[model samples]
Target chain A: MASKTSSDITVIQPPRGWSFPNLREVWDARAILLNFVQRNFNVTYRQTIGGPIYAVYTPFMTMIGYTLLLGVLFGAQEGLSVPYPLFSFCALLVWTLFTNVTQNATTSLTQNTNLIQKIYIPRLVFPLIETCMQLLTFAIAFVVLLLMMVVYAQPFLWQIVWVVFYVAVALVFSLGFGLLFAGFQARFRDMSYLVQTINRLLFFVTPVVYDSTLLPAPFNTLYIYNPMALVIEGMRWAMLNVGEQPALIPTLSAVGVSVALLLVALLVFQRLEPTVADVL
Target chain B: MKPENAIEIDNVSKVYYVAESVTEARGRARVLRNLTSPLRRLRATLAGQSAFGAEIPVKALDEVSFEVPQGKILGLIGKNGSGKSTLLKILSRITAPSSGQVRIRGKVGSLLEVGTGFHQELTGRENIYMNGAVLGMTRADINRHFDDIIGFAGVGAFLDTPVKRYSSGMRVRLAFAVSAFFEPEVLLIDEVLSVGDAEFQKRSLGKISDVSRDGRTVVIVSHNLSAILSHCDLVAWLNKGKLASVGNTAQITSEYLLSSTFESDTLAGEKRFRDFVPSDKYPFELLAMRTYDDQQHVRSSFLNGMPVVVELEFKLGAPKWCTTTPSVRCIGCVGLSRPICSIRDRITSTRSCKFTAKMC
Candidate 1:
């Protein structure tokens, strides 16, 4: 039998204003994070016959639709040296990653109410796990994109390494929004529907299906400020070398804004963490 | 600062702000009242009273404080809505108290419900990892105890099957096995032991005792007084979010039973004659009858496998030349009562008789 000894003491009290999450506790629970990611990855396509193929199929079908509607029917320029299918597919990959991460992370807290009420783990792990799962899907989709690029005979520039940087920006950007919305969604259920509306409207404003140059001056300038647009366009610029070179100042500003939003989201999420179980 | 104290709670209180629905103002008089309500509200506000239509603040716990020494099992008992679960949630850090503080030593693992983080789509093997992780066990720890957990749960055959296909009992078994074997220094278990069959419950209780005897602290929140009396070294009783009493298991439980209306009248030996009317033909009266457990504690309810000792304390008006036998009847809800068993006593010439029946 082990002797009675107090190795450490955990002091808990009501949070006031903002509380910093105990990152060490989260680090200690890395196994739980891995399990959450694995469960999500498996359950996403558990009963489906296609299994992981659906990850590639979704963007493939969307790319075909955009090529027919925007490329041929609407006479929209591909805005890149690569074919319209490859061009729009690259943008679709980044857009899908952002949207999936944001929507899933936003609802992760509400979806895991049973776990939240019954156990004690780092609450931030849910959002982090959701983001990581979406990242895994993005990785799978990236493989499909690589295959498509090879078939299209698109030039693989040395700048392809920069795709990693753009993808990181996209992940941070969506995760920031996810944390913000998840905090509010835990309090007001209407925020879920509101996020859906905002995301739908954001799609039209983002340069996902069409290049930002297609829009007139003010709208194009305003659209450039959207962090996701910078990510999608930057990925295209790095991979295809077809789109205009991203302005250094604007891209750096987007990164700064994403980092700031992430900090704010973290603070808000930590403040609301203690009360989330009660509200749920 | 004492190394022996595992948990210390000081002046903890929780207040909930609940919204109140405003009824619709109807008809002429209601409209007039609604129109003038602002004036009344202003007057009340000037008089230092809360305005009507404000959110109601409910106090779930009020300045409750207690401490538990290491390596002891403490049982918390209370009626419904007495804030026992809230206190447990606070201790588990699921939610923070509205005021005051809680300090806990060592790694705290809480099992508020069975299969808390189990995903329905995941197989039993996968769920074991998920639930174990949720309970604060690392992947390596779970891997090391993998065979032991599967053996304990007896779900090895269904380990590869999805949890949704498993029966509820199997799920609970797997859940309890993982939690019990995780072996946290301080384990907070809610009423999860009440889920399974009699044998499972017995084994679960046995496992809890094993954990207790292993020199770890366990806090159990349960309504089953017998389980508490048998398992807990110390008991705390809560009434309406307030600490009613805390002491030795038997003392607090007995006091709680005595103060509450849950006690049986026969146990107190009060108004035994009123249980049944005396027949003029028989010239005999029933004095008192009650059931008790093996510990000699009077219990009005019993689990399926427990031994029951029924005692009949009665007065015989006339010591006639007839043998007196005490029989027990099984009554069904369909209003059918049949004599299932009886205990025959030798003929006695005494006015008072006491018959005891032991049924295992």
Candidate 2:
């Protein structure tokens, strides 16, 4: 043998009817998580003519379609003087990141049926890796949005750096929702579709296409407390310096709510992990 | 748990929910059932009954209890669905037991599949590290054994080629090589030896022996009796969902093979063969068994997919009324269940119907 093995004892017992997340184990197994991340990245563009080049242009192309549909068909309406294309692109970029992250998270466990059923890595690794992939895609889309800012002759706001914070909030909340549903999707095959439909409906509720500040009072009220609506509007404020500057009270509370939701979702994920393996 | 015991499983049981009511419903009906399940469950709970028994609880493993000593190989033998796989799954933490506990003394690595996480787009070298990492090997451990893994797999020439381009044999060899080098303190192997070519099996058995010699404990679940008999110091037999017996390998395994009601379902033989305890109901026992090649030379291993003749020597003294099954046409001795028959394409038969038998 080339090396001496570590002698760590493990005790396996019946689940105690509640599951508390094993954060230490998840941290210790980070290398396996990296390998999973590598596998996903390596396979993402296989057999495609453009390869990972699509990562750069796919979001750009989708932006084009949105620009025509939303920017051209529906002109800029009281958007505080920013070009329609730039405003919508900023919102669309954040929205896409949320949907992509949530969609992948919702199906992560069910997609790797072979790995989950045969091997014993922390199941949390799947959704976590997916979140990483979505974040990487979000970075690429942010770069594209920056290039658009130059084309529209938009001012380079130092506040643009805060876009990262909005991305974090979107990701954290989407991950929480995705993880909670991914666990369910393992047992109920209908859950993936349900999550996708919910995502579609969520887009309209979120201030992705239209300005929440310009909406009537009852609807503009969404910007105050809803984490997702706060995220989209916050991204717009950070990118275009639009709408009431997303007050510190709302921003801090939004972050607090999203983080709390993630913690609860993680707990639910741990509780459902064992039963999910059986169904998958 | 004793200091010498590497694993102590106390009354472990794994339960599964078989959703019959949901499964029986057609497409739209299935969706409807899924939608109304919570309400139905509520109604049933109010009535102190079940929600149409949709999920029938199955004890795949029922109160199975056993111990494996350090530096030894313990074999788990059981019929199909007798909970062998379920027990291994519990030990490996792939699934949790419904009740009871299992305490293992050291780090555990399970080889349930040969190449569980191998990506087709990845090269052989990349897969080596990835598979090793997935199986709980640290990056340093993989680096130390990298050269050995390559040499063992004999795929140095194609190390950089994507696994998809490799021949099927090459893939199997590469997959086996990574698993063979996995050095956990306690190893749980479940019939993974039945994979790959014959020479690969030899290397697998050798690796297993190497692991045992290193003072690590191994718990193997396999239907290959000869492999188990040659390697295991102790054996546990599971009948139905419970542990039937555990003791000396030679004794428990032979009793397990002869006593198990495995092929009895198809056989018209006497009901005595179905006895959970062969010694309790009948005096019949398997004396010795061996495998022979076409040249009639005794051998411990056979080539992959090749026809091999297995000879079984059994004691026979059943009552005249306990007639043997007609399907079994023995060439020698008064009647028993053994038949001097032929079974080709015996890819993975736990119990073959055709074998030569002699009454001693």
Worst 10 residues of 1 chain B by lDDT: B331-340
lDDT of 2: 0.77
Task: Write down the TM-score of every candidate.
Answer: 0.84, 0.81
Looking at model 2, residue A211 earns an lDDT score of: 66
Candidate 2 lDDT, B39-58, residue by residue in tens: 66435432323334455788
* lDDT of candidates 1 onward, in order: 0.80, 0.77
What DockQ, on C-alphas, does every prediction get?
0.41, 0.46
Say which candidate scores most in DockQ.
2
Q: Model 1 Cα RMSD, Å?
A: 7.1
Model 2 misplaced stretches (Cα beyond 4 Å): A1-7, A56-58, A77-80, B19-34, B37-52, B261-360
lDDT of 1 at A254: 84
- Residue-level lDDT of model 1, residues A187-212, one tens digit each, is 65766787788788999999888877
